[model samples]
Target: MRTLSGDLIAHRLSQAPAGALSKRLYDVLQTAIQQGAIATGSRLPASRDLAQELCVSRNTVLAAYEQLQSEGYLQTRTGSGTYVCEQLPETAPQASLSPSTSSAPFNHIRLSRRGTRVLARSGAGAYQWGAFMPGVPDVSHMPHDIWRKIQLRLSRRMPVEALSYSNHGGCLQLQQALAEYLRVSRSLNCAPEQILITAGTHQALDLVAKMLCDPGEGAWIEEPGYWGFRNVLAVNGVELLPTPVDDEGMLLPDLASFSQLQRPPVLICVTPSHQYPLGSVMSLQRRQQLLALAKSAGSWVIEDDYDGEFRFGESPVPALQGLSADAPVIYLGTFSKTLYPGLRLSYMVMPKPLAARMKMAHSELYRGGNGLAQLTLAEFIREGHYAAHVRRMRQLYSRRRAALVKVISDSLGPAFLSQQGNAGLHLILSLPERIDDVALAAELEQKGVLTRPLSAYYIQGTQRRGLLLGYACVEEQNMAETFAPVLHCLQRRLSPA
Candidate 1:
């Protein structure tokens, strides 16, 4: 408990005019307790005496003190003066529970104990690499003013019911909008009935895994794939059968290399449009073959189209879902890369039977996706803002990709083989036999150039020596300046012997 005159409280309250005097006083005292400025058992002044000292009415002091007492910030026993509460220190937003492993099965946030190093931008760090961060969209490019206005306008005008927990599937309007968008862009043949809104592609992947995989069962995850898939699958106890990927993409024969589980493989996780880490796009012939293999093996293909929208060179490739007319293919895509990461909106195109299955699954955990954000995004796509954004981003990403390629080629000088798919934000720089790719990535990080080693994405072995460098987040005008440091890294990695 702490003693303070009403005059002292008045001086403290004047700092935050937006907040009430009582609230400000309570906050000041609360922070003092948190910082250990006021130790336990300190006594506060009597209301009447504090009022008299400050020349304020007794009622004002009483009301402020009384509010604090009721809220458990202060304690007042019969005939006892006010004292600070002995409970936990106060905070605006109470800290979330420490990731408890024993409380519940699903209460944990699963992350890999191996090779799961995210770059500075995604982690807790100060200096930024300008704006070039992987898996991040330029939020500054988003129509924020228009979106805020829409949110405000909608909140004021819409019926209260419209703002409540929406339809389990998603908003009808959004589903309709997505159905239309998918048809045009990805060549996905489905109506609003087949689409389900998820927190993002990560959620979509988790849900599919939950519905599809039994513990200790097998799932084919592409080698040199996204680390997110590994984290999600490991958390669910799905035994990952790491299928190796060459230039052609996921090798069917190499997947047969791993020991089979009790259950047959349930899913084949892939990034067909652009393989993660390696940045190799799966060929159309291979896509058909992979679907046929999945069909024969009685497994589903989980298409992780994380960056389906940003493709350059030729026309955008049709998704594997489009190829799988009869086969069971769960198509996953996200607006996180297309929009901003904070939006946390992704969708899935499921087969009818699986859609019914997920309905039951989401019923248990996921109540529903964000309604207002979904609704506004639906409008954005329907009115063609999304398409325009993708087109603009494609051009920008292409330039950055080219810049990365040129710099790496010049710096490495014949060690690099420029791969084909000039579509996405990232590209792979092939390494020679002598240098370990992982060590090279660490070396680059020391020089203040962040790049992901392709080996981190691999499970068992047979990963090519390479590094995945993202340029989509980099500014076109600043590519030369940004690539300068990276060029030095390439020189160091490419040095003789």
Candidate 2:
């Protein structure tokens, strides 16, 4: 009848890895019981005696004893003090692991079919900030002080509901604020109830894919389009139709072509305002044609109004959603490009008919919370700060774009500039067909010049060789110096061997 005495426990406790006193004591006693150091049904020293002997508090020993007893390592026998349980928590003693066995390489984990598809596609870059990182904004210019004040005000009157898991579309204040802003700014015809706030464009697209599309359905996306749209649909096992785009935007396929397909496309995603990478505004004729085609095909059109707020020349085009009263268009927009990416705030304005169902599905799939941020943004917009900020950023980006374009033209040539749109943060720098844009982009990155290869955006059709230079983040004063490395690299790549 071996007893777990204070001396033995103290030694084991010392041997136990550094941790809280109660935890160390508990681990030591548990190990002793498991290893049969103390025989089954053996008695333990009283808490007071053990505490005094080990120079610890009686409460610490009591806590360890209580935990051990709870875990079936020790049992309390009322007036009989503490005893080891005859039956251990584990079925049997853990086998000692050999050094080789412990150090062996872990077995490979096989991913699902969907997981494999997602892994095959990569859109995210290693670095998010710095010169020429496309689709990223100048976060330094963001009104942090104003945002902080708004957040602080909301915190003082924070409601219990703000902390709870929200299911309803989103913060009502934000939805209303966005509704008003969109109606006036973008000519979007949507009520506050039609909007569903999401955690960035990824979540918004994911939710749309899940709610509207199924495993085998067809989704038509613009060639040289946003890689994110392709990834989202790919994960859902949706068949992607990489429709080509011209100067006008996504070329709407003829009605006859739709009927010829084994699976007609149920959805079409387009960046009509300013086509991604290429930066071509979809023509008014093309926009009308697209809406008509969608109507005839009974397809949903997702209008991603990315960077629509930063047009340099002409007034911004009205969103595709407002083309018709009952247009089958889902308008998508985000504050990431407008404000800062960290906010993780984006919105989807659903067609009136789909609004209720989509909101219900959103709540079921992704519980919303971020009430404070949403509320602050609402106040920001309501107070006209949002508009003022956009106006300021537009002017700033315009200057930066002009400086970058001039540098490229002076260093390379005017012919290198491709589809330099009046809007958006980025412009395309077309390269010679022989130059591998991917390899060139890699070299440019090493030289501290970050640019996305235009060829990488194409899913199908003839690959165009170019680089998407995001000039919005770069300061106008530093544009010439910052682009020197890129120009040198391009000259080296383009020069004869």
Candidate 3:
């Protein structure tokens, strides 16, 4: 039996802080065993000897040993000293199981082409909430108290059916509430049966991509549009055709031009309410034209109305789906901006003909949960709290947007120009043609400012140089202070050294 020297244990224990002697001793010994400094099956010094060497009471050493034994780090033998466990608990450090020289063969694993593309364009930053972090709403102001009360009420009053797996679309209450709300607010014509609840817009897009288009079919996405839309379509093996966006919105290719191609787009996605990054509302004329084109081409339109609720203009524009009676448009909306992102509740108003299949596919692809939350949100909208909250946030976001615009004009001067459109929570600051927006964005991030480079949104052709700055989560009072770092970074970069 090999015995561990009291001197070696004392040396290891000496490095630990002066805490409860037993706990400190236990931690030190545990780490030693985990690191393989103490070999398995080696007998440890007797409690009295270790206690004397470490200058701790024998009772403390005994307590430490007892803890180690209970935790499976040490094994006690009848009429024998405590020994390091031969078979440590499953929670034992993996490093202790093998020689340090061995390496994992991670390079041998192969990812699909689709997976590789998805990873290549993952521009999501580590930090999502801060000054000028685009697309995030002011979740700090969400009505948590009211939401919690509703959640509790639903939990208690809900029937047993609410707790089980929901094989259908979603909670009927939410669908009905959403149907009524959409009719009045967004002019969306939909029955309760047509609404399908999803985790968020990404899942909605994924389902639509799967159902409407086959693999290798062409899908038209707005150039300089939402990256989430691009990635989701790419991962599903759909060929993405980047259609350019002008002041009016997506500039659709002529039908003759599409006919020339071997595979024309069967799916067309647009943020007609407020075009992402460069907030341009699709003109009424263009909306009709696009609808007519889609109807003729046998194409399905996906209208992402994300953040349309908080439009800061005269009046919110009606959704594209409401423009015609049987328009082939899937209207997508989410509570992430109005309420909170963590809620992860979004819905799509599907056409009656395609509704059943999409719902079944959604259920089969991703099973639904969070029934209580859906029920609570249904009550929230039914009781008019959702509308009330939207009104309040609209005023708050408008004020913050104005403050940020003024700060940018004052700080950046003619060097940067704010782009068009007064709707949506973010503003685009167009940079000088020569300046690299990506590098500037990186510098700004290091100084505690978050902004998305406009160039990153473009997939083809000449990319615009600008920054998308979100002001919804930023307060009017702190706007100047929050923008100071960005101004400093810009000044430092543009200054003649």
Candidate 4:
């Protein structure tokens, strides 16, 4: 066995004579580390030094080192030398000498729970009305045939590189298409380099959470807001402050001046175009104020434009990121709401400087979503299918929303208060006083009408009792029939007679 420079010795493969010993060395080192022979925190030799000691080519040493790294046996710290990862398990013998275990009561390390996350219960697979669904598009009438043709054509003409991870920033064609689409449609003033394609809004949120907010820094969230946003912030260990939201979205004046507060938020997340749960779009006047405040405070404003593509009436409001002069805002838009949520395609528009860092983080995070899907979507957006599709769905959803509104008015009466946010898939039907929304929803579920309660979206005091009803998926003809029973259930629960 040839001893390597620092601490490694080659484990001899007596049976096999090998010319390229790097592959064998890599496997041996990996097995040693995994089996705990080479303990965690142990350092390996420099590639050049190890090569000389082992009497092998520098390439062989380099190859072996890289293989160990890719397999997670060793981790490279920026500027610091490669060390055996703390992620690597230690041998039982090493544990015997540990002061904590040897001197104190013995207990096994729970790898399943410790150093790992237990995913919080999400509303996945559960059919609940009005929960902030991560990915559900008004796919009631998307032109699948057209999309399929585009995908087929793209696949045929696509370079072999398209089959592999093309670029960390995402597909170039898609980025170009998105940039052009945003400029005219969204009024976003940015180029393709500013966009970092991501796997839906969840990944976008997670990336922003990782990038801007340090642990314990405040990330101001809306009270009674979309739970997923709060969940992302919460799991990241951000100090969350729930600001109140009322008739207008995000109650700008209520944003507790971070300067006045000791722990000022480094980041602020808001669904400005259309507030989730309550479904109130932040007014144009307040949009300016939010930008001014975020600029003044020098905090990054994360505008999650989830359902911004759908505006059934009036001129489309300008994106807050577009309106803002300070380049601190990170704009997030996803096809989950605009197209099919199952597509799992979304993008983040970054300020120039942040884009470079975001790209570095992205490659480390996920080399980007599937290259094939990105290619398909690129053609969809490039050929004008995306915009045309949204226009059709917007009209379709408008009819369903109107139908839901009518059914609520007639069956539940005008006495039950409601939120008046137009241009989203769902709306909140505020209930009368003294009715338990959660309990009522359960009763409604048994009647085969699944509706969401506003109480569940709340994390603070003074939560309103109501149901969140999504109209996008329901057919305009069936909207009345589908909502009739739900409305009756809410009415019967609140009746005084």
lDDT of 4 by residue, 289-345 (tens): 777777767888888888887777767867878875455789999887777777888
Q: What is the C-alpha lDDT profile of model 3 across 99-157, one tens digit per residue?
A: 22245645887898888999999877899987799999999999889888888888888
- Provide the RMSD of all predictions against the true structure, rounded to 1 decimal: 10.0, 10.1, 9.1, 13.2
TM for every model, in the order presented, reads 0.74, 0.81, 0.82, 0.73
lDDT of 1: 0.71
lDDT of 2 by residue, 315-384 (tens): 7788888989889999999999989999999999998789889988888988988999989999999999
Q: lDDT of candidate 4?
A: 0.74
Give the TM-score comparing model 2 with the true structure, all chains together: 0.81
**Residue 244 in candidate 2 has what lDDT?**
85
Which is superior by TM-score, 1 or 3? 3
Tell me how far the alpha carbon of residue 382 in candidate 4 is from the true structure, in angstroms, after superposition: 1.4
Can you tell me which runs of candidate 2 are displaced by over 4 Å? 1-105, 256-262
Residue 279 CA displacement from its true place in model 2, Å? 0.8
lDDT of 3 at 256: 73
Ranked by lDDT, the better of candidates 2 and 4 is 2
Query: Model 4 clash pairs?
Result: none
TM-score ranking of the models:
3, 2, 1, 4
